[model samples]
Target: MTDFESTDRPYAAFPVRIGLQVQPQHAQYADIRRTVAAAEEIGVDVAFNWDHFYPLSGEPEGLHFECWTMLAAWAEATERIEFGALVTCNSYRNPDLLADMARTVDHISDGRLIFGIGSGWFEKDYDEYGYEFGTAGGRLDALGEALPRIERRWARLNPRPTRDIPVLIGGGGEKKTLKLVAQHANIWHGFGDAETIAHKHAVLDEHCRTIGRDPGEIERSAGVGNKSPEDIGKSMLDVGTRLFTVSSSGPDYDLGLLRDWVAWRDEVNGE
Candidate 1:
């Protein structure tokens, strides 16, 4: 077993933060906007949306909005809360172009953008959008290639990003994905129970060590799905996860869970 206690994980000093993934499916944009507003008002730390052409759950043909465009609106509409796609599919757009888009939104939000990205998965999204659905390894390789281009483009852009826009890489593929996270991500978001996430954190820490990067520099983030603060929150917190995100889908976009998590965060952070 790896000694997780050896290195000082960066998140150990970070206060607990709660994020709300206002999934853009099965709801009108107005409702989505309202949800964001409510989240900000409730003092949630970050608001996020997934980058997909269609809904991930519910009706296949349900109402869905594009990711970056809606993010632009969020940038202008809200203040104080950071926002971005939960994880933008790297295959959907060119690396340089995506960098420019992220920079523009960064400016719009006065630097509240988190550049979350991942290797493309959803086959339907690729097929419907006319992107080639290649093998998983091929896609991961592409993501590995794209990240550098994205960074280089950010460096080349005029009126560069307001701040070093935080890069949040989502996925738990230990070999490729975690390696990428160790190489680039400022925040690493993954899905799993507390025990599983703790194991991933250990794997990620080892990757960081191999590359000579501080394991603490990358924040560990997880999705809180149906689990209350009392259920998995403390367990995740004890395991070094500083960022916890709860998702709410369109139409209703109920923020009750988000509010509960926010309260939990405040309690944990002693705010």
Candidate 2:
């Protein structure tokens, strides 16, 4: 048996959740706002945007909005669905400052913020934004150092977070990233097909064992990239992935896929 199968998976207790990534590119703020509202109305469990200065897809120089600021606006625009960047780059802001910003947003959203973060990538963002384009290992090390500072900052904030903000770290690196996920994340977001994701889960579970943390304590999240729920959702669910995200890019933030995923989630959860 694989390491994950050898142990009991307490993740069955977590209900299936659907997330929509409202890609902040090629669209106006109004379109993005409307999309977030629609996703909330459709009963998505979370809304997310990526942390990037430019578009990751489609016309590279296309219109784009900053991540955290848009998230703060999402806090005010939507009422129920939790929201945050899919993964904020650790190199962009000071850990303490980021913590304070997250705390403020959490309070604004009435504790609905999910603080998803990761090591820096997308070198164009670094070069254009005037941040250092460090080695990948250096960025990972920085992320490792920043996580604790962020937690400590939360403790010291004036009117601390409304609740302990859930930290969602996104990446699939088996060594440093998975270990960091075991050490700090409440949710681990990865990108892959079922076999790939199942392998990552096993690695993550092993990391949890080394740290003496329960593997089930960390939620598993994956992207539903153009695949129908009937095609890939059951396999992902069988591997203990409870959060499935669909990404909608703007000018037209088509949510047809999101609707399918939401229906699938409800069906699987017996809602």
Give the alpha carbon lDDT tens digit for every residue of 1-271 in model 1. Answer: 1222223456576678999999999999999999999999999999999999999999999999999999999999999999999899999998999999999999999999999999989999999989999999999999999999999999999999999999999999999999999999999999998789989999999999999999889988999998899888777887888899999997888888888999988777666
* True-structure lDDT of candidate 1: 0.91
What is the alpha-carbon RMSD of candidate 2 to the true structure?
2.8
Superposing all C-alpha atoms, what RMSD in Å does each candidate have to the true structure?
3.0, 2.8
lDDT of candidate 2 over 1-271, digit per residue (tens): 2222212566655788999999999999999999999999999999999999999999999999999999889889988889999999999999999999999999999999999999978999999999999899999999999999999999999999999899999999999999999999999999999899989999999999998999989989999888889899878887888899999998988899999999988778777
TM of each candidate vs. truth: 0.96, 0.97
Q: Which whole-number lDDT from 0 to 100 does residue 109 have in model 2?
A: 94
Candidate 2: minimum summed lDDT over ten consecutive residues — where?
1-10
TM-score for candidate 1 = 0.96
**Candidate 2: clashing pairs of residues:** none
> How does each model score on lDDT?
0.91, 0.91
